[model samples]
Target: MPITYDSQKRIFKLDTKTSTYALLVYRENYLVHLYYGAKLPDDNLASLMYRGRFDSLSPYNPKVEDELFSPDINPLEYSTNGAGDFRISACSVRGENGDTVTDLRYVSHRILPGKPKLPGLPATFAGEDEAQTLELETVDSVTGVRAFLLYTVFEEYGVITRSVRFENRGSAPVVLERAYSACVDFPGMDFDMVHLYGRWAKENSTARHPLQHGIQSIQSKRGMAGPNHNPFVALARNGCTEETGEAYGFNLIYSGNFAIDIETDTRGCSRLLMGINPTDFRWKLSPEESFTTPEAVLVYSDAGMGGMSRTFHKFYLNHLMRSEWAKKKRPLLINSWEAAYFDFDDDKLAAFAGEAQKLGIEMLVMDDGWFGNRCDDHRALGDWAVNEQKLKGGLQSLIQRVNALGVKFGIWYEPEMINPDSDLYRAHPDWAVCARGRDKSISRYQCVLDMTREDVRDNIFRQMYDVISKNNIEYIKWDCNRHISEAASLQLPPDRQGEFFHRYVLGVYDLMDRITTAFPHILLENCSSGGGRFDAGMLYYSPQIWASDNTDAIERLTIQFGASLCYPIASLGAHVSANPRTSLKTRGNVAMCGTFGYELDPVKLTEEERALVRRQVADYHKYYDLIRYGDFYRLTSPTDNPFFCEWEFVSEDKTEALTTLVVMRQPEHVFHIQYLRGLDPDRLYREEETGEVYSGALLMHAGLNLSCVSWESPDGDSLVRHFTAV
Candidate 1:
C-alpha cells in the first residue's frame, strides 16, 4: 500500500517510488505538515515539526495552555483565516453574521483503493491498482463547516494530487471568500521560483527569480488562462540546474481565473498556495451543499528541473488526457490561415487540397471564412450558418471536394463570441456579457457570450451540431480571439455575481463534453488567439494546441523550448510558416520538433522548395514514434546560450534517440559541444548520418564539438540526428 497510518505517532504517511509526504495530528486536532521530499524508510517524522514558545503569542487551545503550542508558528497543513496565524491562509469563510473567520480541526479520515471523480471538472484518472486516495475530514466547531481534504498518490509516477471540498453542515449558509486547493510549507526560503509569462505572439517564455521576503506569484484574471501567465510554478534550490539539485512543480487542472502564490515569512519560512484566485470570487454554500475546488498536482524531484519535467510529462500523458487520439500518431496537416485567411473560396481551397495531396499532407484545414458573412474578423461571429457566397456550394460540398482529392477536411469556429453585426447578437443583445448601465467593451470587434446561461449554450450547440453532423469533418480548430471584459452576467442575482467566472468555466466544460460525446472521431484542437488558453484544463478535451501565432522558425525555438519544460512535445502544434527570412530546411527542422505541419501555400513555393517538402514529410513519418512518446531532455538551453538551442528525445527502453540543434548568427567563431542524455552508459550507439559509433558514456561525457557553421549561409541553420543502440 502507498498510504499508511502510524497510531503511536499520530502521523499519516504517503509514499511513492522516490518520494514521501507525511503529516502529523497534534493533540488530536491540529494538522501539521512534517516533511515532503526524498523517500524515508519509516514514518518516524514527528521530530521534524519542532515547537517553540513565542513571546506574547497566544496558545492554540485554552484547555492545554501550552505556550510552545502556538498556531502562529506551526506548519499548518490547511491554514485558515483569523486563526491566530497571520500568513496567507488556504481558506476563508464568512458566517451568517457577515464576520469572516474560521478554525477547522482534524476530525476523521478514510483510505480508498483508487481515485474518485470530481463532478463537472477535468481531473486525472487512474485504475485501482495504480493509485490510492486519502480523504481527511476537518470541521469548524463554531459554524459546523466541514472541509474534506483529498489526496491521491500515484505509486509509480512519484506524483500527488490534492483538492478540497467544502460542505456547509450548519443551519445558516456560509459564504466562501477563499478556497485554495492545496498549500505546503517548507522550512527555509533559499529557493528560486520559475514560471512562464508572455503576451499573445510570444507565449510560454520562461522566467525565474529567487524567493523574496514578501509574496511572489503568477496569476490570470482574463476569464481564460491568458497568454500573459501560465497556470504553473516551480521551486528549486539555490544552485539548481537542468539535471542537478532539488525541484518541486505545481500545476492546476483548470482554465479560469487562477493564482499560484509563494510567500516567505519574517522567520524565513516559505509557504506555497495554488487554486482559483480569491479576487472577484465568492461561493455561497447552502446547508448540506458542498463546493469542490479544482485538483492541483505536485511533483518532487531530487535530480533537478529536468527530472521534475519528465515526471509531469508522463503523468499528464498517462492520466490527464482522456481522448482516444492522445497516444495515436497525428496526421501531417496544412492549414489555410497563413495561406489565404478569410479570402479563400471553395475553388481556392480545392487548390490547397490538391497541392497538399501532391506533397503527401494528410489533412487540409480551411480556416476562419466559411461561415456566416465572415470574410473578415469584424462581423458574423456567433452565426454558425455557412455562407454560400464564400464557399459557393456550402461547407459539405467543399469538404466532399477536398476529400475526393485524398485529403481530410477541417473547419474553424469561435462559438463563444458574438459580433453585434450578426443575427444571433441582434436578436438577444443580453446574451453577451455586459454590466448594467455601462457601455459594453469589445475586442477585435467581438463580445463574449454569457456561457452561464443554459439557453445561450443550447443555441450555440444547435448551430454547431447542424454543421458538424452534416459534414464529414475530421478536425475542428476552435478559437477564442479576445479576452473577456465587463464580465457581468444578467442571469445571476447581485449577491451571486462573484460566482460568474467559476460558473462560466463549468459551462465551457459542459459544452465540450456534449460535442466530444456526440462526435468521438473528430480531432479537436483549441486556440485562444493562439496559445492563450493552452493549459492542462484545455488538454482534457483537445490533444494539441496552437502554440503561438508567430510561426517564424527562429522565434519558435524559444516558444516551443519553453513549452516543452512542462508540456509534452505532441501537445505543441508547430508549423512551417511562410516566413521568407528563413530557409525551407531550417523551418522544417524546427516544426518537426512538435506535431509537424505546414502553414503556407504549397502552390506558391518554387519547384526546388516543393521537393524539400516531400523529403520533410518522409522524415516526419519516419521519426514520429521517437519524437512523440520518448523521454525528453534539455541538453543546452536557449536562454543560457543565446547562440544555439539543443534538446533530445530518447526512447523509454534506451535503444533509440533523436536530437535537434538550431544555431543562430554568432558574433565570432565559436565551438560548442552538446552532450547527449538518457542512454545506457555501457551501450554502443551508431549515429545515422556520420555512421560513427561510440559508447553512450563517451557520448554523454566527452560530447561532440559543432563548429562547421562558417561555411553555411548567414541566415543560420539547423541539424537533426538519429542514433540507434548497437
Candidate 2:
C-alpha cells in the first residue's frame, strides 16, 4: 500500500518507490506539510515541522490562547486566502459578506485503491493495483466552503498527482478569484528553478536560474499553453547533475493560461505553486456549486534530472495517455503542407503519395488547402467543404486513390479558427469570438471561433465528424493556428465576461472528447502553429504533436532536448525535411529521435536522395520498438555544449541501444569519444556496423571513439550508432 495513516501522531505518510510525503494534522484540525523527499522507513516525521517560538514581529502576535494560529509563518498543506498567508495561495474566494478570507480545517480523509477520475479534466489514470489515492476533506467554518484535496501516489514511478475540488455550501454565492492545483513548501532556498521557455518555431528551450528572495515564476496568458512558456518546472539542488543529486518536478496537465510560481520569503522558506493562471480568471460558485482544478504531477527523483525525466516519460506513457496507439509504433508518415503548401491538386497529391509509398512511407497527410477557398492563408478557414476546384474529384475520391496506392490518407483541420471572408463566417458572423464593441484582432489571417458557444462548437464538431466519418481517413492532424485575441463573447453576461478564456479551453476539450470518442480508431496528431498547444492536456487527445515548424536539424537539438524534460519522445512529431540549410542525413538522424516522419516532397528527391530515404525508413522500422519505449539519456546538451549534441535511447532490459551524435560546429579535433549510459555493465555488446564486440561496462565508462571527419557534411555532421547485446 502506498498510503498509511498514523492515528497516534495524526500523520499521513504516502510512500513511493524512491520518496515519501508526510502530512500532519497540526492543532488536531489544520493540515500541514511535514516532509517530501527521499523515502524514509519511519513514520515519525512530525519532528521535521517548525517548532520554534513565534518571533516578536510575527502576525500571530501576543500569542492568543484560543484563536487559530496565523498561517503566514506556518507551512500549510493547502493555503487559502483570508488565512493571512500573503504569498501564493491555493484558493481565494469573495463571499457575499464582502470578506475574502477562507480558513479551512481538516474534516476527514478517504483512501482508495486506484486513482479517481477528475471530472471534465485530463488526468493520469492507472490500474487498480498500480496506484492509490487519498482524498482529504476540509471545511471553512465561516463561509461553509468545503475543499477536497486529492492526491494519488504511483508507488513504482515515485510520482504523486494533486488536484483540488471546492464546493460552496453557503446560502449566498461566492466568487472564486484564484484556484491552484498544487503547492509545495521547502524549508530553505538552496535550490535552482528550471523551466522550459522559447518562442514559435523554437519551442521548449531550457532555462535555469537560482531562486531569488522574491517571486520567480513562469506563466502563459496567451490562451493556449503558448510557445513562450511551457507548464513545467523543476527544483534542483545546487550541485545536481543529469545523473546525480535530488530534483523535484511539477508539471500541470492543462492547455489553458497557467502559472508556476516559486517564492522565497524573508525566512528563506520557498513555496512553489502551480495551476490555472489567476490573471483574467474568476469562477462564480453559487450555493451547492463546485469547481475542480486540473491535476499537477509531482515527481521526486534522487537520481537527478535524468531520473526525473525518465520518471515523467514512464508515467505519461503508461498512465496519462489513454489512446490505443499509446504503446503502438507510430506509422512513418509524409505530410504535404511544406511540400506543396496550398498549390497541390489531387493529381499532385496522388503523385506525392505514390512516391512516398515507394519509399516505405505508410501514410500521406494532406495538410490544409483541401477545403473551401483555402488557396491561401487568408480565407476559408471555417469552411470545411471540399474544394472541387483544387481536387477535381471530392475528398473521398482523393482518399480512395491514395489508399489504393498502398498508402493511408489523413487530412488537416483548423477547427478553432474563422476567416472573415469564409462562407461559414459570412453566414454566421456572430459565431466568431469578439468583444461586443471592439474590432477583433487577426492572427494568421484568421479570427478565433467562439468555441465558448455550444452552437458554434457543435457546428464545428459536426463539420469535423462529417469529413472524418465520410472518408476512410486513418489520421487527423487537428490544428489551432491562432490564439484568442478579443476574448470577450457577445453571448456572455457582463459579470461572466472574465470566464471566456477558460471557457474556450473547456469548449476545446469538450469538442476533442466527442471526436476522439466517436472516432477511436483514427490516429490524431495535435498542432498549434507547430508546438504552441503541446502539453499534457492535448496529449490526452492526441498521442503525438508536431514539435515545431522549424525542422532544421541543428535547431531541433535544443528544442527536443528541452521538451524531453517533461514530455516523452513518442509525443514529439519530428519530420525530415529538405531544408536547403541542412543535410538529409542530419535531418533524418534528428527526426529519428521523435515520432519519425517526412515533411518534404519525395518526388523532388534525386535517385541518391531517394535511396537515402529508403535507408532512413528501413532504419526507422528496425529500431521502432527501442526508440518508442526506451529509457532516454541525455549524453550532451546542445544548450550547454557549443560544438556537439548527443543523446541515446536504451531499452528497458539494457540489451539494445540507439545513439545519435550530431556535430553542431566542427571542432579543431576530428575525433571524439561518446560515453553511453543505461546499459548492463557486465554484458558484452556488438556494434552493428563494425561487428566489434565490447564490454558494456567499458562502453559506458570508457566510451566509443568516432571519426567525425567521415560524417561531416556541408551543413553539419550526424551519425547514428546501433548496438546489440551479444
Candidate 3:
C-alpha cells in the first residue's frame, strides 16, 4: 500500500515509487508536516519537528509550556489566517462575527483503495491497483467549518495529487475569503524558482530565478489561464540542471485564474501555496453546502529536470487525459485560418482541399466565415447556423466535396462569444457577461457569453449540435478569441457575484462534456486565442490544443521547448505556417516536433515546396507512433543556446529514436554536439539517412557532430535523423 498510518505514533506516511511524504498529528489535534523527499522507511517521523524554549517575543501554547510549542516555527500541514502562526495562509474564512480567525484541528482520516473523482472538475483518475488516496478531515470549532484534505499517491508513476473540500456544518453562513488546494513547507530556502511567463504570441517562455527572501509568485487574473502566467511553478535546488540534482514541480489542473505563492520566512524556511487565485474570488458556504477545489499535482525528481518532465508527461497521458484520442494518431490537418481566413468561399475551399489531398494531407479544416454574416472577426460569432451564401449549398455540401477528394473535413466554432450585431445577441443581450447598469467591455469586438447560465449554454449548444449532427464533420476546432473583461454575470446575485469565475469554468466543462458524450467520434481541439488556455483542464476534453498563434519556426523552437517541460508533445498543436522568417524545411522540421500539420495555402506553394510538403506528410505518418508515444528529451534548448536547438524522441522499448537539430539564422558558428537519451547503452543502432552504424554508448556519450549543418545547406539550417536499434 502507498499510504500507511502509524497509530501509536499518530503519523501518516504517503509513499510513491521514488518519494515519501509524511505528516504528524501533533498533540493529538494540530496537523504538522514532517518530511517530503526521497523514499524513506516506515517509521515515526515526529522527531523531525523542532521544539525549543524561546524568548517572550515568541508565543507558545499555554497548554504545553514544557514543550514550548509555537505555531509560528512549526511546519503546519494547512496554515490558516489570523492564527498564531502567520506567514502565508492556505485558507481563510470569515464567520458571522466577521473575524478571519480559523484554526482547524485534525478530526479523523480515511484510507481508500483508489483516487476519488472531484465533482464537476477535471482530475487524474486511476484504478484501485494503480493508486491510493488519503482523506484527512479537520475542522474549526468556532465556525463549524470542516475541511477534508485529499492526497492521492500514484504508486507506479511516482506522482502525488492534492485537493481540498470545505463544508459548512454550522447554522450560519461562512464566507471563504481564500482557499488554496495544497501547501508544503521546506526547511531550507536554497532553491531556484522556475516558471513559465509570456504574453499573447510568446506563450510559455521559461523564466528561472533564485528564491528570494520574501514572497515570490506567479499568477493569472485574466478570466482564462492567460498567456501571461502559466498555472505551474517549480523549485530546483541550487546547481540543478536537466540531468542532475533535485527538483519539485507543482501544477494545478485548472484553466481559470490561478496563483502559486512561494514564501521564504526569516528562518530560511520555504513554503508553497497553490490554488485558484483569490483576487476576485469568494464563496459563501451556507449550512450543508460544500465546495471542492481543483486538483493540484506534485512531482519530485531527484534525477533532475529531465526526470521531472518525463514523469509529468507520462502521468498526464495515462491519468489526466480522458479522451479516447489521447493515445491515438492525430490526422495531419491543414487549417484554413491563415490560408484563406474568412475570405475564400466554397470554390476556393474545394480547390484548397484538392491541393491538400494531392500532397497527402489527411484533413482540411474550414475556419471562420462559414456562418451567418461572419465574413470577418467583427460579427456573427454566436451564430452557428451555416451561411449558404458562402458555401453555395451548405456545410454538408462542402464536407461532401472535401470527402470526395479523399480528405476528412473539420470546422471551427467560437460558441462562448457573442457579437453585438448578431441575431442571438439582439434577442438575448442579458446573456452577455457584464455588470448591471454599466456598458460592457469588449475584446475583438465580441462579448463573452455568461456561461454560468444554463439557458445560455443550451441555446449555443442547440445551434452547434444542429450543424454538427447534419454534416459529416470529423473534427471541431473550438476557439475562444478573448478573455473575460466585465466578468459579472446577469443571472447571479450581488452576494454570489464572486462565484461567477468558478461557475463559468464549470459551465465550460459541462458543455464540453455534453458535446463529447453526444459525438464521441469527433476530434476536438481547443484554442483560446492560441495557447492562452492551454492547461490540464482543457486536456480532459481535447487531446490537443493550439499551442500558439505564433507559428514562426524559430520562435516555436523556444515556445515548444518551454511548454515541453510539463506538457506532452502530443498535446501541442504546431503547424507549418507561411512564416517567411525561416525556410520551409526548417518550418516543417520544427512543426513535426508536435502534432504535425500545415496552415499555409497548398495552392500557393511552388512546385518545389509542394514536393517538400509531400515528404513532410510522409514523415509525419511514418513517425506518428514514435513521436506521440515515445519518451521526449531536450538535448539543447533554444533559450540557452540562441544559435541552435535540438530535441529527440525515443520509443518506449528503446528500439528507435528520432532527433532534430536546427541552427539559427546567421549563426556565429556550427560547433555543436547533441547528446541523446533513453536508449540501451550496449545496443548498436543504424542511422537511416547515412546508413552509419554506431553503438548507443558511443552515440549518447560522444554525441553527433553538427558542423555540417551550416547556413549554406540546400534545405536551410535544419537536420532530422532517425535511428533504429540493430
For residues 168-285, write the lDDT of model 3, one tens digit per residue: 9999999998899999999889999999989889999999899889999898888889889999888999999987899999999998889999999877889999998999999999
lDDT of 1 by residue, 1-726 (tens): 899988788899999998999999887489999998888988778877754656574446665455566677878899999988788899999988788889989999999988999998999999988899999999998888999999999989999999999999999999999999999999899999999998989988999899999998898889989899999999999998999889999999999999999999877889999999998899988899999999999999988899998998888888988877689777799999999988889999999999999999999998898888887898989999999988887888888998999899888888899998899998999999988778899899999999999999999999999999999988888898887778889989998889999999999888888888888888989899888988988888888889999898888888887888788788898999999767889999989888889999988988998899999999999989888888899887877777778889999999998988877666365667779999998999999999999899988999876666523536458788889999
lDDT of 2 at 550: 90
Per-candidate Cα RMSD to the true structure, in Å, reads 1.3, 1.7, 1.5
Model 3 RMSD, rounded to 1 decimal: 1.5
For each candidate, what TM-score against the reference?
0.98, 0.98, 0.98
Model 2 bad stretches (over 4 Å): 61-69, 707-715
Deviation in angstroms for 178 in model 1? 0.4
Which residue pairs come into collision in candidate 1? none
lDDT of 2 by residue, 612-638 (tens): 999999999998888889999999999
**Which residue runs does candidate 1 get wrong by more than 4 Å?**
57-59, 709-713
Quality of model 1 by C-alpha lDDT: 0.89
